[model samples]
Each structure stands twice: as structure tokens, then as C-alpha cells.
Target: MTILVSGKNGQLGHCLVDRLNFSDLDYISLDKKEMDITKYDETARIIGEIKPRVIINTAAYTDVEKSEIDKKDAILANESGPENLSKICKKIDTPLIHISTDYVFDGRSEIPYKPEDDVNPKSFYGMSKLAGEQRIQENCDSYMIIRTSWLFSEYGKNFLKTMLKISKQKKTIDVICDQIGCPTYAGHLADAILKPIKKISENNFDSGIYHYAGDQECSWFEFTNEIFFVANNLGYIEKIPNLNKILAKDFQAKAKRPNYSVLDSSKFCKAFGVNPSNWKESLPDVIKSAVLA
Candidate 1:
């Protein structure tokens, strides 16, 4: 059976491709240039020709701040794109594995969010992603929506790389401490995603929303501190920058982020027999790659 992975240029897409390369799985990974999901004709044509048994959609407009002003682009990529893919998957009788965000929640809850928790997105980017999730559920009979948080990887632009890059140039930096969430490693998330794909291919698929993220939860400040400490020990960085913790309100961002958006992956762990991503354990590899790049 073949798997079609969208967003080959993305962090998650790159990690997915890395895993797929090591495996014996037959798959095709595409970026927007090759398959613009917002274009129904193009998406349908590509998927129809490939005829993949499973479709993993990692393509999304991820800029939270830009989404507020670029509503058209955000909706086209995050909402319309998923809507198109869902319809195509439904028509072709292919199962869809979609990646979602923790931003779907308003971040009012103190406890980690479950798959069945109420969703009230506070940002346009989150709203767009939520719209995509709803579309997939409405249009596709066989689909798994995995809601992940604070994704970082060796590939692409992400928090881990940003921290590493800025630390080298700046003596100090300020990070918001008010917001709290898990920092998931894309490599681990890619592996978590594949476990379900195997189940789906084996006809033991259980469809619905599932939360998968790092096992440890921390504020952005704490995450940054850990990154610096890890990178320093790994000799990737010569010095650790002074990290200042500030409230979210003090930060000038166009988007309103959740104060708390930690996800509960117990459901996913029980179903897939996989543990939540150990982001700290995988930090060394990510740091090494970022430093080398």
C-alpha cells in the first residue's frame, strides 16, 4: 500500500519523508509547488493518479500573526485546502491522516486538553485549522485528526532553531512565560503518525481526533532555557543567553495565543501503544543538525 504525504517542504513533512526513506513503505511526498491542495482540480488529479491507500496532510498556513491580516491566504491553505483533500479522500475511499494544532483551544482550561474537549480558538490561524478539522470530519468517513503542539524539528524554521540562532547573536532574549504547552519533536511525531498508518493499512483503523505532543509541558521561557542548556552541553553553542521571562500581555504579537494549551495524549498512547514524544531526549540531534546547517 502507498501513502501520499503533503507538505514535503514543511518540518513535519521533512521528518515524515526521513522516516519513510528508512522504511520499506511506498510513498510520495509533495509540497505546494507540486500539489497545491487549495486547488481542488490539482489535488484531485494528483491523488487520483497516485491512488494512495493513506493520505497524510501536513500542509498548512502556520503563521499565527500573519493569519490575522492574511485571512484570505490562511483560509485558502488551512481551511479550503483540507476541505478539498477531504472531499477527494472521501470520493476515492482513501483514509486521511490530518495534522491539527493545540491553538484550536482558547487556553482557558488548566488541565491538558483531550480529544473530546470543547474548542474555542482565540486566533485566526487556530480558527482556520479548526475549520479544516470540521471539514474533514464532515466530508470524510475514514479520517484521523491528530492535534499536536509546539512542533520543532531539525528541518525548517521552528522554535528550537530560532532559539539556537538568536542565542548565538544576542546576549539576552525575552520569551513569554505566561503561555504553557508541550514542545513536540517532529521526528517523534512522525513516528507516532506512522503507527496509526500501519493500523489503518491492516484494516484495524480507529478514526477520530487524537492529541499527540511532548510528554513534558513547559512555558516558552522554560523551553528556551532547556534548549540553551542542552545546546551548550552538546557544544553546539559557545554560550547560553540570558533568558528573561515576561507575561504574554507584554509581548507585542498580532495574534492572541493561549495561556495554556497542553494536550493530553493518553488516548493516543492507549490506542497506538506509543508514548508521547520525548522532546528532551531528541534535543541533542536537533541541536546538532541546526548548528551544522
Candidate 2:
């Protein structure tokens, strides 16, 4: 079975490449440079010719701050791209696995967010992603919308890398404590994505909107402190700096993030039999790989 992985240059896409390299299946990885997913005709012409058995879309405009002003890019990549992929995949009778985000929720609830919960996006980024999800559901029958949050990894720019860089430059950093969400590792999410692909040939293949994130939730301040703790233990840092907790109002971000976007991943675990690891437990390995021992 041929699997086409879009957004090969991204953190999740890079991890998927690492996973697919070891697998026995036939696969092709392409970044936006190779395939502009927003171009319907070009995307349709290319993907229709290939006729992949499965199409996993990881391409997205992820800059939360930039999305506030750069609506064009965000909508093109996050909204139109998925729509194009879904339509082409549907035409070719291929299973489409499109990654989504927890930002789709308003983050108003105290409890963890369920897959079927009402979506009320707070930011332009969230709105764009939610639009993508809706478009996929509307156009494609064989589709899986997997939503994740607080993603970090060894590759590409992300919160983990940003915090580590800050620790090197500053003695203290103020992170928003009020904002709470799960920290999903790219490698883990990449692995979980494949489980569905493995079962795509089966008649009982489950496909729908699913939530998959780290087992536990923490504030950005707490997450940064944990990163320091793990980095110190791994000898990446000479000393653990102070992480001062601050409210969201003080930060003044261009985009509005939810206060609590922790997704309830029970449904994803039940279906795939793949439970995500805790954020704290997974921190050490992430630190070890990115930093020199």
C-alpha cells in the first residue's frame, strides 16, 4: 500500500518520516515545496495520478500570533489545503488522516475536552483549523481528524525549543500559568497516526474525529519548569532558572489562546489501544535527543 505523507518538513512530518523509514510499506514524503496542498487543480492532478492508498496531511500554518494578521496564509494552508486533500482523497477512494488541534475548543470548561464537545475557537488559528476539520467531514467519508495540543519535539521550532533557548539567554522567564493544555510529543503522535493506517485495509476501520495528547495537563509555566528540571538532570543546563507564573492579560499575545484546552484522549486510546505517555515522563527523552550529553 502506498502512503503519501504531506508536510514532510514539519516536526510531525519529520517524525513520520523517521517512523516510515523503518516500516515495510511503500511511502512518499512531500513538503509544501513539493506539493502545494492549497492548489486544488495541481494537488488533484498530482495526487490523482499517484492514487495513494492513504493520504496523511500534516501541513498547516501553525504560527498562532501571525495568524491574527495573516489570515490569507492560514486559511489557504489550514482551511483550503485540507479541503483539497479530502476531495482528491475521496475521488481516489483513499483514506485521509488529517491532523487537527485542541485550539478548536474555547477552553472554558474545567473538565478535559471530549471529541464530541462543542467547538468554540478563540483564535484565528483555531478557527482556521476547525474550518479544515469541517471541510474534511463534509467532503470525505474515509477520513480521520486527529486533534492534538502543546506539541513539541527535537525538530523544528516549538515551545520546547523556545524555552530551552530562553534558558540559555535569561535567568528568569515569565510564562502564562492560566493557560493549561496537554504537551504532545511529535514522535508519539506520529506513531499513533500509523496505527489507523495499519488497519485501513480492514472492514471495521474506525475513522472520525479523535483526540490524542499527553496523559496529563499543565500550565505553560509548569511545563517550562519541568523542561528546566529535565534539562538540568540531563546536564544540558548548568542551573535551573526561575519560572515565574503570570496571567494571560500580562502577556498580550496577538492571538487569544484558551485557558484550558486539555483534550480527553480516552476515545483515541480505546480505539487504537495506544495510550499517550505523561508529559513529565516523556520530557527526559526529548531533552536527551535535542541537547548534547
Candidate 3:
């Protein structure tokens, strides 16, 4: 049986494909064009035909601000899409490994969020993602919901890439400092997910929500600072932009973000014996790749 991966064009999907290419695993990766999860009949048709042993879903409506304006699209992609996948996975008796976000929490807690923590999402994007998690739990028996935060990589549109682009055009950049979360490297997250695919496929592992992110927590300003620092050290950037620290309240965004959304990954680490990504150590290579790209 093959391992099916969705969102093939996404950063996480790209990373997963890279790892799967070298491994002795038989897998098929599909982008939205091949299999749009939001369409039930289409998704069911494709998945039923493939009959994969395991399905990894990385597709999501991730634009926080855009979600506010395009509520229908966000709900369809984030909630209905997962609902369709869960129902199909259950029908085929295939295990699902779905990616989630830490935005499900309201960020009122001073400590890191646990898998079992109560969720009170403050934004439509967060609410839709939370709804997706619920749909999977209700529809599928064998599923793993991995909630991560602050994803950055050389590929795709993310904070690190945005900062890199802005540094070239502007000498000063203002970033929100009040909000804090772990910075996850997409490549590392893909590795962490792939490590347990065998066990999940064999029904040897537990199925539930898990947290996986960077070990360190920092504000967006700090993350940008580190990005520039790494880029400068690697000679990727001619000059580091002057990063101004601004509070979340001061930032005029359509969506409200959590003040602190750090996730506690002890459960995942203990279960998989894989530590969270060390984004600081991984930043240099990511910057190097982004520069060369």
C-alpha cells in the first residue's frame, strides 16, 4: 500500500517529498490540482482509487488576515476539507496524519499549551482549524493531529522569507514583539512526522493530537532579528534591516493573534523519541538556501 501526501506544493509537503524520495517508502504526493480535499466526491474518488495505507494532510487555509475576509473559502478548506478526508480515511480504514496549528488556543496561559488543553480560538483561521481537528476526531478512529506554530523555511511564503524580501527593499522593518511562539522549521517537522509513519501504518502507535514545534520560543521581532543575524553572517544580505519591536495591539491586522502560543512537545518527544526542531541551528542553512534560490 502506498503512503499518500496532500498539499504537495506546500513547504511541508515539499520537505516530506524530499525525505520520502530517499527513503524506501512507496508514496504519492498530490497538490490541490490533483486532489482538492474541499470537494467531497472528488476527494473520495481519488482516495478510494489509491487506497493508501496512510494519508498525510498538510493542506490548510493558512492566511490569518485573509481568512477574515474570505470566511467561506477558509471554512471550506480548513474545516470541510478535513471533514471529507476524515470520512474517507475512516471508510478505507486508513490512518491519517494531519497538520494543525497552535492558534487554537487563546494564548492566555503563561505556560506552553498541552494537547489536552482547552481551546478558545480568537480568530476565524484558528476557529476553522479547530473545527477541522474536531471533524477528524469525530469521523476517524485512527488519526494523528499534529499542532505546530510559527512555520518558517526556504520554500513557500512565510515570515522568514517575508523578512528576507523586505530587507532588500526597506532599511527598517517593524515586527510584533508582544506575541510569542515557537518557530518551527518545515524540514524538521517533515522529518518528525515521517519517523512515525511505519508505526502509524501498522497500527502500533497511539492516535491523538500531538504538539511539535521548535524547542525555543520567541517573539516575531526576535525571530526576524535572528533571521537577519543568520543572513548577515552567511553573507546572504548586504545589510541587516533595523527591526523595530511593536506590540500586537499596535499592529492593525484583521485577525487577532494569540499573545503566547508556545506548544509543549513533551508528549510527542516521549512517544516518538524525536525532539522538537532547533530552529536556531537550522536557520543558517535555510537562509543560505533562500539566498541561493
Candidate 4:
């Protein structure tokens, strides 16, 4: 089967490439330089040339804080670009696997955000991604919109890498303890992306939105502390410091992030007949790989 992966350099894209290396699938992966989805003509041309049975769109403008000032660029990349890709996929009648985020919800609930929950984005970044979801739903018929959260990987600059860097330079670091969500490893997300595609090819399954993320959730402070603890044990860090806990509002940012962006993965698990490992269990491999790198 011919499958195309966009955002080849991003966290999930990189993970997908590594995971699918030994699979019997013809995959064409492209970074932004190879195919810019922002241009509809370019997107159409590339999709037509590749003729992929499934198009996995991992590309996104993910700078939450910076998006407040760069709304135009954010909208172009997040909303308009996905729309273009959806249109192209629709034209060819190929199934689209688009990645979305938990930020589409307002983060006000005590329970996890379900797939059928109402969307009330609190930031420009969230709004832009939500717009992308809307565009894809309207334009494409055969598509799987997966809403994930707190994605990190060894290939790119992510939260785990940032904390490790900060720990190396400073004796202490302050992280928000109030905001709670899963620290989804990109490799796990890559696996989640592949599951439905295999199902589609084997069973000709119907398409819809699903939430795929790490099994458990935690605050930013807890997640950071775990990173440093693992790093110190793995000899990646010399010593651990006082990890300070702060509230989300204490950290000044241009964008207003969701306070509780945790998503319910029950729907995804049921659809694929697989339950992903929790973040804590899967985090060790990510740390091990990052340490080795």
C-alpha cells in the first residue's frame, strides 16, 4: 500500500518513519521543504503524484505561545494547509489520517475530554487547530482525525528535551503543577497512527475521529521530575535539583493553555482493539533513546 507522511522532521513523523521501517508498505515521507501544503496546487500535485491510499498529515504549527503574535502564519499552516491537504485527498478519494490536539477543548472538566465533547478552544493555537479539524471534516469523507496531547520524542525539541537542557544549566527549575495531561511519546502515537491504517486495508473500515494518547495523565511538574529522575539514574545528569512547583498562571505566556487537556482514549482503544501503554511505562524507552542519542 502506498502511504504518504507529511512533517517528516516533526516528532510523530520521525517516530512513524522509524517504526514503519521494516513494514511491507510503500511510504513516501516529506518535510516542509519537499512539499509545502500551504500551497493548494503543490499539495494537489504531490498527492496526485504519490497516489497514496492513506495520507498521514503530521505537519502543524505548534508554537502555542508564539501563535498569539503570529496568528496569520498559524492560521495558514494549521487551518489552511490541512484544508488544502483534505481537498486533495478528497479529490482522489484517499483516506486522510490527520493529527489534532486536546487543546480543542476548553480544559474545564474534571473528567477526561471525550471524542464527542463540545470544543471551546482557549488560545489562538487551539482555535487554529480546531479550525483545521472542521475544514477536514467538511472537505474529506474518508478520514481519521486523531486528537492527541503532550507529544514528545527524541528526534525534535520537546518538553522532555527542554527539561533535560534546563536541568543541565540550572540547579533548579519551576514548572506548572496545576495543568494536568498525558505526556504522549511520539513513538506510541506513531503506533496508534498505524493501527487504523492496517485495519482500513484489511477490513475496509469506516473512518471517523479518534483520540490516541498515553494512558495516564499528570501535571507538568510531575512529568518534569520524572524526566530528571530517569536522566539522573541513566547517568545523563550529574545531579538532581529542587524542582519547584508553580501554577499555570504563574508562568507568563501569550497564549492561554487548557488547564486540563487530558483526553479519553477509550474510543481509540475500542476502534483498534489495542490499549496503549501508559506514559510512565513508555517514557523509559524515550529516555533511553534520548540518552543514547
Candidate 5:
């Protein structure tokens, strides 16, 4: 059976491509340059030709700040693109595995977000993604929506890389401590994505929204501290910098982030039978490959 993966250039997509390479399954990954997901006719034609049994859609407009100004493009990618894909998937009777974000919540909850919780997205990016989820629920019968948070990996631009670069340049840096969430390694998430692929084929899994993230949670400041810690161990940097804690507002970000966005992924573990990876344990490899190398 063939699986089609969209957004090949993204961090998750890159990791997914790598993970799928070691597998026996036949899969094809596409980036926007190859396939504009917003163009329904073209996407439909491409999928028709491939005739994939499963579609894993990681495609999204992820720029939180840019989405505020570029609502049209963001909405198109996050909302309309998924809907169009879902419609085709529904018609062909192929199951869809869609990647969503923790941004769908406003970040006010003291505890982790459950799938059934009332959603209140504060940003356009969050709203658009939530819209995509709603659209998929409405249009597709067979689907899995996996919501993740603070994703980082060796591939693509992410916080880990930013911290590594900044740490090397500056002896001291400030990181936001107010915003809290788990830093999901894309490689771990890629593995999680595959855990259910076989189950999907066996028809043992049901269509529903699930959360998957790193095992532990922390603020962005703590996450950065861990990055420097790993980086120092990996010998990427001679010394770790002093990281001063600051509030989210102190950081120059256009988008408002949730104060607490840690996702409760117990449901995913219950459903997929795979436990979440510990971010600290997973960081060494990422630091070696991306930061040190």
C-alpha cells in the first residue's frame, strides 16, 4: 500500500520522509513547489495518479506572526487545502492522517488540553488550523488529527537551532518563561506517526482527534536552557550562556501565545500503544546531528 505525505520541506515532513525510508511501505512526499495543495484540480489529479491508500498531510502555513497579516494565504493553506484533500480522500475511501497544532487552544488552561475541550484560538494561525480540523471532521469519515506543540528537529528552522546559534554568539541571552508547552522532537513525532499506519491498514483504529508531544513539559526558557545543556555536552559550544527568564510579552513577538499549551497525549498513547519520548533523552541525538555537527 502507498502513502502520500504532503509538505516535504517542513521539519515534521522531513522527519517523516526519513522515517518512511526505513520502512517497507511505498510513500511519496511533496512540497509546495511540486504540488500547490490549494489548487484542488491539480492536487486531485496528482492524487488520482498516485492512488495512495493513505494520505498524511503535514502541510500548513505555520508563521504565527505572518498569518496575522497574510490571512488569505494562511487560511487557504490551513483551512481550504485540508478540506479539499479530505473531500477527495472521503470519495476514494482512503484514510487521512492530518497534523494539527496546540495553538487551537487559547493557553489559559492550567492543565493539558484534551481533544474534547472547548477551543478558543487567539491567533489567526490557530483559528485557521482549528477550521481545518473542523472541516476534516465534517468532510472525512476516516481520519486522524494529531495535535502537537513546540515542534523542533534537525531539519527546518526551529527553537533549538535558534538557541544554539544565539548561545554561541552571546554570553547571555533572555528567553521567555511565561509560555509553557512540551518541545516535541519531529523525529519522535515521525515515529509516532508510523505507529498507527499499520493499525490504519488493519482497520483497527477509529477516526478521531488525538494529542502527541514530548513526555515532559516546560516553558520556552527552560527548553532553551536544556538546549544549551545538551549543546555543551555535545561539545557544540565550549560554554553554555546565562539565560535570564523573561515574560512572553518581553519578547518581541507579534502573535500572542498561550500561557499554558501543554497537550495531554494520554489518549494517543491509549489509542496507538506507543508512549511519548522524553525530550531531554531525545535531545542528545538532535544536538549531535543538528547543533554539534
Candidate 6:
């Protein structure tokens, strides 16, 4: 089997490339230079040429705040890119595994988001991603749109790296306490993606949206504290600073993030027959890899 992955340099994409560890399948990882998925004709042409059995699209305009002012770019990458890829993958009778986000929910509900939950996106980024999901469903037959949240990895820029950087440079930092969600490790999510592929390719599985992430929900404050603790334990920093807790409203941003977008992965676990580890347990290894000794 030939696997084609887009956004090869991204946080999740990079991990997937390094850790997939499959010897039987040939992997073709593409950065922006290899293909600009925003153009439908070019995207379709390249995908049609590759004729991959599985196309996993990880590309996106992921700057949540920037998306507010630059909705066009967000839509182009997140919405149009996936739409084109889905159309081509469907045309070739191939399976498409598209990465989505938990931001599609409006953060109003206290309960964890189900796959069938109504989406009322409060940000341009979320709206664009939701559009991508809709496009895949409309354009494809064999598709797995996986929605994840608060993703971090050893490679690329993410919240964990940001917090580590700040912990080293600053004496004190303020983190939002009101916003609660899971911090999903990219490796776990990437591994989870493969299960569906095997099931779909071998067992003739059903196709739809699935949610996967690190188990356990936490606030930004809680997550940062844990990150610093792990970094200190791993000897990444000489000292850990005081993390001040602040409300979400106090930290103004261009985009409105869901306050509690933690997804219920029961459905995904049942369908895929795999469960993710908790963030606290996953953080130590992540810190060991990304942070210094």
C-alpha cells in the first residue's frame, strides 16, 4: 500500500512521518512546496498521479487568532484544500483520512462533544475546518475525518513548546484557567489513524467522523503546571516559574475558542478498538523528546 501525507512539516505530520514505522507500505510525504492543495486542478492532478491507496491530509492554516482577520487563507487551506483532496481521492476510489479539530463546537455545552453534536463554530478557523468536514462527506465515499484537540508533539511549534520556551525565559507567566480541554499527543493520534485504515482496507469498515485525543481533561493552567513539572523532572529547565491563573476573557484573542471542547472518544474507541493514554502519563515522554536534558 502507498500512503500520501500532506503538511509533512507540521507538528502532527512530522510525528506521523517519523513514527509510523510501517515497512510494507511506501510513504510519500509532501510539504507546501511539493503541492499547493489550495488549487483544485493541481491538487487533483498530483493526487491522481500518485494514485495512493491512502491519502492522509494534515495540512491546514492553524493560526486560530490569525484566522479571524485572514479568513480567506484559512478557508483556502482548511476548507478548499481538503475539499479538493477528498474529491480526487473519491475519484480514484481511495480512502482519505482527514484531520479536523474540536473547535467546531461553540463551548456552550458542559458535556463532552459527540460525533453527531451540532456544530456552532465561534471562530473563523473552526468554521473553515467544519467546512472541510462537510466537503469530505459530500465528495467522498471512503473517508475518515478525525477531530482532535490541543495537539502537541516533539516536533514543530505547539503549546508545549511555547510553555517550555516561556518557562526558561520568564520568571512568571499567566495561563488561562477557564478554558478546559485535553492535550492530545500527535503520536497517539497518528497511531490511532492507522487502525481505521487497516480496518477500512481489510475489514471493509464504515466511514465517518471520529474523535481521538489524550485521555483526561485539564485547563491551560493545569496543563502548563504539568508541563513545567515534567520539564523540570526531565531536567529541561533549571527552575520552574510560577504559573498565574487567569480567566479566558482576560486573555483576549481574535478568535473565540471553545471553553470546554473535550471530545467523548467512546464512539471512536468502540469503532477503532483502541483507547488513548491520559495526558499526564503521555507528557513525560513528550517532554523527554522535545525538551533539553
RMSD of each: 0.8, 1.4, 0.7, 1.3, 1.2, 1.5
By lDDT rank, best first, the candidates go 3, 1, 5, 2, 4, 6
Off by over 4 Å in 5: none
Give me the candidate number with maximum lDDT.
3
Off by over 4 Å in 1: none
Candidates' TM-scores? 0.98, 0.97, 0.99, 0.97, 0.97, 0.96
lDDT of each: 0.93, 0.89, 0.94, 0.87, 0.90, 0.86
Q: Candidate 2 vs candidate 4: which has greater lDDT?
A: 2
Candidate 5 lDDT tens digits, 1-293: 89999999999999999989999988999999887889999999999999988999999999999999999999999999999999999888889999999999998899999988889998899999999999999998999999999999888788898888888799889889889999899998999989889778545687899999988989988899888877787788898888889988888887887899999999998888888767888888888778543
Q: What does candidate 1's lDDT look like per residue over 213-255, in tens digits? A: 9999999999998999999998888888888889999999999
Q: Candidate 2 residues 225-275, lDDT tens each?
A: 889988988889997777888999899799999999999999988888898
lDDT of 2 at 13: 98
Per-residue alpha-carbon lDDT of candidate 6 for residues 142-238, written as tens digits (9 for 90 to 100): 8888899999988888999899989878999999999989889998888787766655654276789988876899999999989988888878878
Return the TM-score for candidate 4, rounded to 2 decimals: 0.97
> Relative to the unseen true structure, what is the Cα RMSD of model 5?
1.2
Query: Which prediction has more favorable TM-score, 1 or 5?
Result: 1
TM-score of 6: 0.96
Model 4 residue 174 distance off true place after TM-score fit, in angstroms: 0.6
